[model samples]
Target: MIHSCPLLRSLTLLLLMAGLTFSCQTRNSSDNTTEQTAALPPAPNFNADSAYAFVARQVAFGPRVPNSAAHVQTGNYLVETLKKYGFTVTEQPFTATTYDGKKLNARNIIGSYNPQASKRIMLASHWDSRPFADADSTQKNSPVPGANDGASGVGVLLEIARVLSQDSTKLSLGVDLVFFDAEDWGNSAVATDAYAGFCLGSQYWAANRHIPNYTAYFGVLLDMVGAKGATFPKEGYSTKNANEVVRNVWTTASQLGYSTYFIDQQGPSITDDHVPVNEIAKFPMIDIIHMQVNNLSQTFFKEWHTTEDDMDTIDPATLKAVGQTLIQVLYNEAQPVI
Candidate 1:
């Protein structure tokens, strides 16, 4: 989740639902065709249990806050694991100044497959958990376990890397899996400048990409995706900045029969890593983040930024829903040779 410190006094709340409807109508007319009924491709076998275990493995490493031993060890684990999965792993180590003037040693890990292919897709998620559970009433100053928030998305991506390694022929396009650090090291709720402290690793990567002049067809960022019961509505910034990308992901989710988890509703604008990717990297990027419409909390999942976001809340089914959808999307993009 991105932070918005001191509140933007001039920013207006953009009602995304209405904007999506209009955009859909325009897209449908321009396409002028019903949804294609291509034979459903073979199901990409994404194992939920394996993904769950990956999440658990990260939690066992303790809180991966930046500048800590746990953070360094976990970063190494990610690099080695991806290398074992047949990816050409690259690590970008940099120092970032946090909102409160703390310099953090952050690493952005990138794993590339089929680097020769010109058509590429990027998938990313932040690996560092927030240092302070500022949102939790009882443990306002304590660090969150971040099982669902931090580890979940990385787990799914790691599992995807594993599958890609087992069957290289399954992927035709180049794929890059990026694990960004220091995303959650941001200002507290009481801070004067919120967004200033967040997404440090991504901000750095956007400015200095792993591969010089690197470009992707599109990118997707996953966050809070392993909650027991999660809903992914179209984020406002995604719709405004990358409407086509959002449509593609939502359509793929629907075709995979995961429509219940990927609802058609529009969520509020979020200040996630995708924002910098879209604005700076110039990639049309979308965010698959958990949001609850009926819940009283408007921003994110229930245990967001709380100590309760531990391993107990990491549900395998939710991981499966997200991982399978991502696999299906990638497979759909794979063009078979004539």
Candidate 2:
């Protein structure tokens, strides 16, 4: 939701500039580190129409700002949908203090499949819209519709949950779908700290997990994935903290012929929900976010954080590209020997 040079990178730069002597130590590592490939089954078809409907349903609820009636209704809809799809649902409700000293009634919705399975994969997205369109010239104080910024990622995951519920035997490992709230409420443009109010729901979840001692093999967070001609580059923090996960997802996308959207380029580190997950929860997570690498002023999509982020900006083809790639990744994963 907010973009910044990660503090880790800054500290590393400082260390390098100081010319600190570091010892080079090497150890014998296994050459056969790759997991064994199994005969893959056909993945469930990702229906773009179904995903689009999910996005539309959330948009119809208006801007899902925390503490608003629309926010509560949309949270209920997500929990109900996950239950209908046969997931063991969990809701973590909490009160979060915003950067401006306002209390937000935030809730993190989780849908667990094969809860008994020890090995699991986590997928997450923010479902709360920005309370103000701070980037827009007009209606700067008005709430953003967040059709692509908030609803798009959640929509893709909901469709995935539906497919996984109908056919549980395809993937042996468990899948957890998390819808984090209050991610877009930060005002980074005016603050010295980039990660202030952003990712409040994820920050809460990382500290107090829904399930006791919950851990996943790895996590993937989706954001702004339904815009037309969206390009997702390897974000800096993801590359720095979870390089293997970034490589895995990007390589999978390339193999699936979706290389155009998942570009092999370096992107600026964003202060998003994934940061808190990787830092606090100690999970390896990567963000599949649309960013403009060429333009510093408009790093994200043009409509990002703007009132113009409505249903008209969402593209079904973009949704299909991301959703299908995820389906491939999740289904292909073998149960790790944990």
Candidate 3:
């Protein structure tokens, strides 16, 4: 969920500048480029059904509202599943106060593959569903199922982890799959301070990184990515903050014949978790979120923050498009000098 308020608009621009500086520096480094092309691995097969099943599992757990029993249980499920997939798991537990003055017991789950490699990429998604279906006309005050909003991105990442574990020898660079909590507990649209309440877990992680001095080649965030016939236009903040990263991912998506889904159009600026990661953590991060150019509301996907965000709205094809694109991107990156 996002509010395009004037104050947030100004802050978004400043954040974009800071992100561009870091992203440009990374791309300009001579070490990142090589005259001789390296032999890239075959693209790993992305299983859409597996990804869809993962999304279903999250929805089956019910709405994972922060501080709720479902939220805690779902966190445990993520940790155990990642461990099963041969990832080195770490949990960052913290307390955050929301705009409504409620204290949340939040946890950020980190899963690492090939931790020994210096060249790394970070993939992230918010796991907690929004507590209110403010965008639903019928159930405006109810909690959302968030099958696409919260679970879709994590489902894709979990499937990636499973594939990586199955064929560990194929990967050349390290991967960190992070599932952030309390991302959807922000204030409703009617609130006076909407932006302040959003992305609580990401803000905490940015200020205090799980690993000291943690750095990655680049980071990609997925949100509202599992809806049927979803289209991921170039988000405004991503274009301003990490244009190169956006180009890289969109290029890969096009090459994979996903051009129809990853359209080359500018999307509205959103104050998501990636915003804090770009501003505070200084990571060259971009968001691959669903947006519609012709929609009545300018914020997000059709069923966003609504009770209709249930499993039926999720599509395996969209998950495959995004998951396959990331696999291709990682496989193309040159291994860092040890």
Candidate 4:
């Protein structure tokens, strides 16, 4: 999932479903003629239970605010988990000043697999809990539980990491999982400009990537993807910036029998993490974010920026739809060597 957003997080728009093209070639030998078609690689099964547990574990740590103890603990946990899953992990720590001039100690955690492969794919999600619940009428100063907005995306990616590690399938390309920090400290609700201070982690990463001169074939981002009856439309920016990536991913989801969830509609542009990746890093990325169809502007989840965004808002089915779709996308691109 890759797209751009405001309080909207990392995200995409869509190209037409028919844009994804495949071809088979024929070779005429002296003895016989043969046709070779595209191979269907087996995508590892995405475990909803495991993904759910990962979400729950993050919630138990309380809000992962940039300067909070929970933030530090969760960072350590993420690093250890990726390492356990055989990824070479890297932590990029940097300081950033927020919209209100508050200094944030932020770190972008990155996990790399098959570093030697030049062809690569990137997956990303923000990992910080919002410091304020501005969306709720009450508890305006309370921190959001972030079950969907932050933790849900990370949980799905973590499950993917586990699957990639456990499965014997040898991927034809490299994969990078990036958990961005300080993404939720923006002043969307309190400010006149919606995108004044959002996506700090992505902004930093886009400018200073973990690997110098690093590039990928494409990228996908996930945000607020584990809610009940979650709807994923083609984000406005994604449709325009990386329509091909959107077409391939959305088409894959539909092929996997998830057309109900991944709706083939246009969504509003968001100022999320994927914005910088596309605009600054020059990467073609798509955002697989959950959005409401009725609301054109700020179509985030109802519990977004609210304290009510807790474990109760998370649905295992939604997680399965998103996680499984991502796995399929990866495996579909894989071409094993003889």
Candidate 5:
């Protein structure tokens, strides 16, 4: 995904230059309500080593680019892994014609926990690595390893599934972990308003949902979540569309003593997979992505969309922060809102 607005990025820089805090202006008003949401039962431990291993496994498959053997192998591995955790898995296969006119075979993989429950929440991450590392100085056409951009988020969710499997009690709401495919095949030159080819799997799934009239209370999409020294401010689109969910998540992260990573800052708008999930599916969703106003070259992490986004870029500590926060969020939502 790309940072959607240069103006917003500039504004963030100006604010930082002016010595202003990057917090949400309206956060105080809803703090009480969000605080209530974060005060639920404690979540199970999120193992960083296990999550790291999962990330390594995905990277081991090489780049999971569309229509490639590695892509098919990784897809099968994801399905089998989800099934091992007792999730009801479904594969929604489709053909997506990208902006450059490449017809790619893609599938959005879904894993449902507590499928019978009416109340539900969605967690998602793009599973396919970018076909080209355009951001790299050399090897501009080579495939991205996607250790942080793709695999990290999936690894976190997979660990969540494993942790949930070990828990004894039933959750309060159903959970859907969606591994979106064909998300990184678009032309990076015109990524923002004209990013039609990006996030193909989500766009398709939103229009032609696997379940008839399927809906969720809220959703969260994770991207670029395992980079070293990564910071996840509240993304702009999420604040616009799913402020309640953002407030709760940020509050929970702070409560868990991770305020450093999950800051109170408001990040730039990102054109990512969650946009379709919000606009097309008509479900409020938020994006937890790594964006830095401090980065001179790009708003994303240093290795974004580059061949350098390999296993060396993956940070176990960063993974633990995001994974643990997500686990806390889910367990918190497992309790009925008071």
Candidate 6:
């Protein structure tokens, strides 16, 4: 998440209930009427251990700071891991100038399943760790470990890729697992540009997609999703831009009995990678990020952007909830025509 004192201060608290009801609109030729119905599909088992291991591996590389050796190694590792899982991988490499006016080498790694299919689903997460632990008073200048913030989402996606590779027959729509870099480099506190630095890789990818004229049925971004007792309230921008997608995902989570983790409440909007994907790419996307109420940090998770955000803070149960919910959503999606 992007952090600015003003943005955090401007958070509007709103809450809404998330129920387990699936609605589908059916149009009738007579009188141009429409009807809605509900349906539930069986979901595959998501292994929490596997997802946990992936997060651990990323953290083991040390902080994935942009232009750092750890960042390059982590990027290569992600690309190779996806390829191992039978995904057609593509790397979008570019240079981005941070808010502090430092040019950094960034890459957006994409793993595609069923590359021939036109209808697709995009799952995204940032793979870069923050350069500074700004939120931690003890080590404000130290780099964040980013196990939960940066690696958690990617770890879940990697596990999803592994699960999907085991059985492509479960899904009809193609899938793209995107790992964006340089997402944590922005400082809303001092940046003069409204949209610069943060989410640099996503902004670039959205403006210049790997495939020409690329589009997706919908996209889901996972951010800071593996903290113990984490809660994911519906983010403001998601409701404003992709309310239907948000509903579908929340409903799916509820049906799977993960309502506690996937809270049915409206949350404050924050700057995230999905912002650029929605605005620049013009795609419907929702972020499944952790959120907290009445917190001094004004962050979703307790260890956000801090040195404490390490493997010790990771929880397998949280990973399982999110991973299982995503698997169900993908498997239940209708086949869109190519």
- Among these predictions, the greatest lDDT belongs to 5
Which tens-of-lDDT digit does each residue in 281-303 have in candidate 1?
99898999999987764578888
TM-score of 3: 0.85
Q: What lDDT does each candidate get?
A: 0.88, 0.89, 0.87, 0.88, 0.89, 0.87
Q: For residues 3-110, what per-residue lDDT tens digits would candidate 4 score against the true structure? A: 444654432322322233211222233113211112345678999999999999999999999999999999999999999999999999999789888999999999
TM-score of each candidate structure, all chains considered together: 0.86, 0.86, 0.85, 0.86, 0.87, 0.86
- Candidate with the greatest TM-score versus the true structure: 5
| Candidate 6: residue pairs that collide | none
Ten-residue segment with the worst summed lDDT in candidate 4?
30-39
Task: Give per-residue CA lDDT, model 5, range 1-338, as digits (tens).
Answer: 22355664677676664453325434664685567545557778999999999999999999999999999999999999999999999999999988877899999999999999899999999999999888899989999999999999999999999998888886878999999999998875654435556889889999988798999989999999998989998999999999999998998888777888999999888889999989999999999999886666678888888999999998899999999988888888777656
Could you tell me the lDDT of residue 150 within candidate 5?
Answer: 94
What residue runs in model 3 are displaced by over 4 Å at the alpha carbon?
A: 1-41, 188-194, 334-338
Residue 184 lDDT in candidate 5: 90
Worst 10 residues of 6 by lDDT: 14-23
Candidate no. 2 TM-score: 0.86
